[model samples]
Target: MGLFVHGDVGTAASYEPPYTLSSGESVRGGERRLWDNGAACGRRYRLRCLSGSNRPCKDGTVDVTVVDYCRKSPCPSTILLSTSAFSAISKSPSAKINAEYIQ
Candidate 1:
């Protein structure tokens, strides 16, 4: 099981693209590269989650790379992901999640 933190992009700025590193730092071009390589920002992830919601409950797997930055103040960390990223690992959306990071 992964320590998944799930939240709406609108609610959590971390869910935005151009993810801000927890270190309050980032690498130049790192975010763009991830997006250029077919990564989904919050928009894409949300669509996947909504779509997944319509399907039979199962452990859906999606390969998601974080991109951009979510500036919401209440988010625990700047690590943002597409809801599709969460859907890949979670079946329930109503519960709070602690997501595991895949290396």
Candidate 2:
């Protein structure tokens, strides 16, 4: 999974439909696969960090709502977890870590 600061336009989930995140709730942006052509918007997912080299993984899951679409020419990851969400599952928020996510 990848990580992005909430509202950071560069890698933000800026897709349409006007979404807002609940207080204290984790959120993410998904690529085409998870986006499902916008159907994945508002979907919920539970993500667990599997492994990474930079002391990345933590033990437990982070539940996240899909708030936006992640569109990049060469997608970096399936999902881009908000910084807070990434921190919940990994120690290194900037490092890309393998994650197991489910609906």
What's the residue-level lDDT of 23 in candidate 1?
A: 35
TM value for model 1:
0.36
lDDT of 1 by residue, 1-103 (tens): 2233553322111132343443322211123322344343322232122222334334433444343543334444323444444445446543234332332
Who wins the TM-score comparison? 2
How much RMSD separates candidate 2 from the native structure? 8.5
lDDT (Cα, 0-100) at 95 in candidate 1: 27
Once fitted onto the true fold, the runs of candidate 1 whose alpha carbons sit more than 4 angstroms away are: 1-61, 76-78
lDDT of each: 0.34, 0.64
lDDT of 1 at 90: 49
List TM-scores for all candidates, in order: 0.36, 0.73
Candidate 2: where are CA atoms >4 Å away?
Answer: 1-26
